[model samples]
Target: MVTERLSMRNMTKTYGTNTVVKNVNFSVLPGEVHALVGENGAGKSTLLNMLSGVTMATSGEIFVDGEKAVITKPTDARDYGIAMIHQELQNIPELTVFQNMFLGNPKTKGGVFVDKDREAKRAKEILFELDPDIDPWEKIKNLKVSQQQIVEIARALLANAKIIAMDEPTSSLTPQEFDRLAQLISDLAKKGVSVIYVSHKMDELFRVCDRATVMRDGQYIDCVNMKDMTEESIVTMMVGRKIEKVSHHSYVTDRVMLEVENLGRVGTVKPASFKVHAGEVLGISGLVGSGRTELFRLIFGLDKPGLAVAKHTRMSREIAGLDKPANGKVIVKGESIKLNDVHEAIRHGIGLVPEDRKLEGILKSRSININMGMPSMSKYTKGGFIKRGFLRKKSYEIMKGLNLRPLDVDRAIGTLSGGNQQKVIIGRWLASGTEIFLFDEPTRGIDVGAKSEIYDAIEELAKQGKAILVISSEMPEIIRISDRVMVMRDGEIVAQLEGEDINEATIGQYSIGQAKKQTEAVL
Candidate 1:
């Protein structure tokens, strides 16, 4: 019989009267890449938290190397050779890569002062093993999201961790970066390290994981071999039902609701033009740092817009504008509106669901009702007093419409899963009567089931004749939901694809400038 490297018998967790994680059994073999997958609120996070010593299990027996281990704190887990890398990284942005790597426990000289040379040397060695391009002397703030993730992994490796659990590791990675990460995981497993990989991306799980443990509604379902299961089968096991593939239909109308002419930001976004119809979903696709988010910020009035120097001469000649050659103009409902700030954008009926939901989107400490009604508070208030009853009723109605889990408007938004928190953000805009919606990485870090729900909501909004603009890193998501796609490269829109032209291959080529090079060659 093969002895498991780690095992949890009948693990359970509870808070007051509510049990978040029911009795479940899990085990991982040495050098095995195991997958822990489920929908949001399905107890995957709770289980991992227990294993990593973030939370204590109410009832469970943890065995490491066939010996019982009592891990009550993060230090204990670290001592037991276990590490957890959360989706939201724990590195200090102000510190250098090596400093962040040795944040808690640093190499010391004479047991007093930190040995800077020794720390840097060890950090460089581990970081180089993962990605040689990562400079240990560089500040964490200057590094990309993928590079920051590698630093976290290198830190764990430096600590001689035998088991590492990563949550949504590839959520921010580009295809090339993901490939590198996949290779690193394979290497780690070869070195007798156990990896508990958690993600909503099915293709990734199938590629890197050898076996998968499925959970639903806090209950243990079953563990299955990766080769024996299909995406559809695994999804069914997660959701307890077969989810039908949503067929996207064009809802575009002839009436253009939003139009951008010569929209540009100096040193950021290049001069670009496009139009979104009243009932259309336009997707912006590009590699990281392609100005997709910057464009959205300009449109939403979060940032000031400026003309690219190269376009000023030509644009000045085309449009005879008096005041210093206006960089761009935003037209809504056939009227040019000055979007000077976020309030101006909101007044013009534009709502944005920002990419970093936890940071910019929602007030985590507030209740779901408060978050849902925040943007439209005036509508739910009278005579300097909040209409609590009316607000709750409206919030509950919207939550029900969005299929929010638990259906409790009074619950703290922070306590909810990523999917439900996203629903609250969408519900807020709906209450504000937003006409044009801008979703940035709308489904990022959410589960597959929640992704379907979000797609449905976008479809419904489009069907209602509301103009929608989406910026996403996922190519398949762009192809599946977009009526048209705008591919950006180096802060410029390179290709605008529609219908059959919006596949992964076409987007890939355009995103990397291959299509542009080919076109230039032909010209």
Candidate 2:
């Protein structure tokens, strides 16, 4: 019979007046890959933080191998054979790979001096077990995101952790790297190392996890074996409602809102062109490093294009510039928008919901009202001063429309969940009367229920005749919302599909550089 490796009974955590987690029960058996899933602010993080000793639980009982354990600090958790790998990587950039692997537990000589050679040999041996190509002597800062994640995993293993908890470990990893990591987790499970996998990606969870424990609104919803769980059922349990199928409303219009000719960046986006119509959703799909993001960056003026001519039908003017100039031309409503200026982009009714929302989208220290109102401040201004009353009122209105929780305009935007933070970013532009929306991996780290809500918002924008362009790695998202799907491979737009042509199999073919067959028909 399998033994329980770890268990939490009646786990509860509260912050001031808010109860973040309540009466949550979770367990993991030896040699099991267990998933902890929930929407943002659903208490998943709070519970994990408590278990890892990053935060103290207001009330709970933790057991290790059937023996009650006391964990008041991170070291205590480590002492009990628990180690956590966070979503954001935790490694010093200046340190070497081997150095980071044996960070806290360093090798010493004669009781005092550091023994670098011995540690390096051991770190090399361990890293080779995961990836034979990684150099132990390489600096952590110079390694790819995937290699850095491997280093973190190696650290946990070096600590001899009996149970490893990972939080969105593959969020930044490539598909190939993710597959490798999945195999590594499976091997660890086979060796009797229990894993608590936390992720928002349904495909990854289903592919790697044996059992799933779900939470909602700070309460335990259910825990079930993977054989009995479907994506719909799991999502339903998360949000307490049946998530309706995403139906795309026919929004193709004759009037093209934006048009581009010869858009390209040498060594990045290849020479490509596309047109977006009013009330249309144009989805861009590709593998990592396929230039989907690079193409969008060129259009938004964040990156200079090698050769491009962009014209907006409503703008009534075209702006042409030199190859690899400081800014690309972006015409909006008859006026040529300054491509290099972010503020100018906003003024022209263009907004980018960037890939990294936490870093590029929202301000952490500012209040919700400030973060939401800043983009549309001109609307709430009187003479050069912001009208505080109008700002608060308008902010409240936008928050209500998005159903942002707490409804407190004065709360720090950083205090919100991944989903709510994204809402605030999109809300900023929506409040500003944005017309052209560019979403770069909008649902990257958000959960299923929040993804459904974001999809609804995007559809509403398209229905309102706003030109929408979405770049996503998730095939299902691209297929579901796009009226036209453009597949990018090796920095070029290889194929474009509409209506009946857009499907997973077709996209997969184009993505793997096998677009010759479909390109003739579509291009």
Candidate number with greatest lDDT = 1
Q: Which ranges in model 1 have alpha carbons more than 4 Å from their true place?
A: 307-324, 517-523
The local distance difference test score of each candidate is 0.90, 0.85
Task: List pairs with backbone clashes in candidate 2.
Answer: 315-333, 315-334
Task: List model 2 lDDT by residue over 118-189, tens digit each.
Answer: 888998888888887788889999998988998888888888899999999988876778998999999999
TM-scores for every predicted model: 0.95, 0.92
Question: Tens digits of per-residue lDDT for model 1 on 115-204?
Answer: 988998999899877999988889999999989999999999988999999999988889889998999999999999999999999999
lDDT (Cα, 0-100) at 154 in candidate 1? 96
**Stretches of candidate 2 exceeding 4 Å from the true structure:** 307-328, 333-336, 517-523
Deviation from native of the Cα of residue 2 in model 2, angstroms: 3.6
Q: Can you give the lDDT of residue 296 in candidate 1?
A: 91
RMSD of each: 3.4, 4.9
